[model samples]
Target: MQKLFKSSHNAAGALLVALGLCQATPVIASETWHWHGFVAQGLMRSADSNFVNNDGAISAELTEFGLNSTWKLSNTVRLAGQLMYLDGGNRFQQGGRIDYLFLNWTAINDMDWQLDLYAGRYKNNHWLYSATRDVAITRPLIVLPQSVYFDAFRDIAVGSDGLAVTSTHNLNFGELELNWSLGATPIPKEQSQRVISTFINGKTEQDFVHQFSVFLRPAQSKSQWGISLLDSDFNYRRVANDIFADGDFTVQRVMANWRYSEQDWELSSEVFQERVSVYGFYAPGTERTQFGWGAYLLGSYNLSAQSTLYLSHDHFFANKDDKRGYLLPQQSGGLIPAYFGYQRDTALGLSHNIQPNLRLKMEYHWNTGTGRLGPNVVPDTVVNRSRHHELWAVQLMYWF
Candidate 1:
């Protein structure tokens, strides 16, 4: 009835329920219940902020609390839920969204094939790294690999309200998992109430996001590969330096990943090509076209039974029109801004198990890039070295 859609928190709650961890169900036979959660805290000392000047600030913070509890509905059915409370220098927000909610049905157990339906609000499965979109619980490091586009989760990454089906079939080698999903993006009520919301170029924000991908395990224990394709069309109205007016785009994403993981180390590389163009915008009179290519590499090492460390780098190049294709003109760095540029991020992480479930981690990060403003931004041009930034964080985490 109303366009006022659900919030990220609501979507997260549904995710928890769908995951079979937290659900509303009737009583059954002798019940088995278990609870799982994590508590983490950290202090970050930055040289750029308090360390430098106009650089950054020094503050000690943590994820605060991220916990979950799950119930078994049946051997095949389950009810699960998770709660998260967070405060930090990066996440810079309070409250947690549902991690997952829906029923996972296995069409055929004996075979290597299975089917799943995720209803309600859920995260977009655009890339292998999208699953770790959580603020403080999933990653011990302060920031994820930027080249993978994990930085734009939610803000730009598209999630939806629909069903996704995944099938895993075995071949001569390892196995192949193919997935397909169709859905729509979220629309806030305030935007709908407006005579014309600047967000989208249409009367309603209900378009389809279709995605497909395949994962291949070439080597049993050493090598693996993945190929992904995602296409989405949205009615958008963006304005910044000038005005995007209105337009719909068919965005195509091609991703390929190769990795070698063994008993003690993991080396992985990912390459992607994104081709997007406007079928048509709401704008009656305008012209636009955008395209780009990006790539990154990640490596990890198991130092000991208690310690592990890793590093990664990612970069992107685009044309003037491609730079303007972002949902928000301001976010895309103000349209036709610049062409040849990239983002470089370096991080070092160490996780040592103090005792059983208690662990300690220390991470250092150097991020340099240029957007326009806001949060860990680098710079668009070399002369603007003032925009270069540095970040540092140390944390303690425990799970039970």
Candidate 2:
């Protein structure tokens, strides 16, 4: 049955591709509009672990389909968006969501300094290459570790709700970028349990949480170092009772990066940790705190002008069930201390530039899981969340 579904899905996709390729519309335009999109399709009937799928059964699923477009309202300002969809074969939703929707203003174009101001949604200026910060066409992976399975590293509400100002300067030493943002994210009154859900698939409550973050980078061209910090908090008002509470959600993270670059090669490493507090009482509706941390190293050697051999490895640890609130009189949510265990993985991959606009990567990953932390655990009918395990994957990626 599963095999039949997979086959049907692939056939539908191939048909779509054929139709899309046959599209040759006359370039009609009265205004300036530029568009571009790409798809990475394959015949991979592969399987993966699912904690919240129908009967915990494995299935082969198509992995990638992404689109992006931009409109130039002059060179200093543009409107852009990325539309992405993942067909996990009933494991996830069919409709996609926005990464960002914003109007960006470049106020400075000086040789020494530049200032960019934006209103509306935009990526948090946290990492050099955050999961959603950059364009999907240029990302190394079909998926990013920071966004899936975890929410802190690549925050959805971490975007700008109101306004943001970013400045960059070039100096004799290196280059510098300083960013500041103010925004809020909608607290799910309802979310699908197919992914990770706190309550059932319906709205338990509704509201918005405020967020803030900052990042610093010396220069990729100059051997230098940098740091990133984010502090976010949530206070929810009960919809039924109109009662207000503090620290319903809050997270703090700090990451440091160091790199050395020259004419031929580069080396870099990143390390960071997150402490999360979610309000809900295992002990009389109290809050708890969980810790998540990871590190990765990437190095590349120029095999030739058009080819490069690179290796990158990453590992992550998470302690879900910690709800020690950030507000005063901290109390542990104590629903078992930690309902989630941890995940760690390493990937060794290499990329070769077929041309300046195209590249391909081949890699293998070793993944392992951990055991849960608390008691009276209600296994959510998917994977037995109480076990520790391991798995692996081989990946082929391309981008332009």
- Tell me, by lDDT, which candidate is best: 1
**Model 2: CA > 4 A from native:** 1-32, 42-48, 51-60, 74-76, 88-93, 131-136, 143-160, 186-199, 202-221, 234-247, 262-265, 281-283, 300-310, 319-340, 350-361, 371-400
Scored by CA lDDT, what does every candidate get?
Answer: 0.55, 0.47
lDDT of 1 at 377: 18
**lDDT, candidate 2, 1-400, per-residue tens:** 1111111324434433332211012132335554444444322221233421334333334344554445558879966544555444433344444444556889998999999887755656656565343343344443334312232223243343455678888877567767766665433332222322433333322133233334344544455566777676544433343333322556677777777766678776778777767775222377667676767776767778976665666656554332221221133243321323444555554556665545565545444542211111122324433333332222333443
Which stretches of candidate 1 lie above 4 Å from their native place? 1-33, 45-55, 60-64, 88-93, 123-126, 133-140, 152-159, 185-206, 219-221, 236-250, 276-284, 320-340, 371-387
lDDT (10s digit) by residue, model 1, range 26-98:
2222365655666778877544332212334566655556555556666655544455565654333335544
- Model 2 residue 7 CA deviation (Å) reads 38
Estimate TM-scores for all models. 0.72, 0.67
RMSD of each: 6.8, 9.5
**Root-mean-square deviation of candidate 1:** 6.8
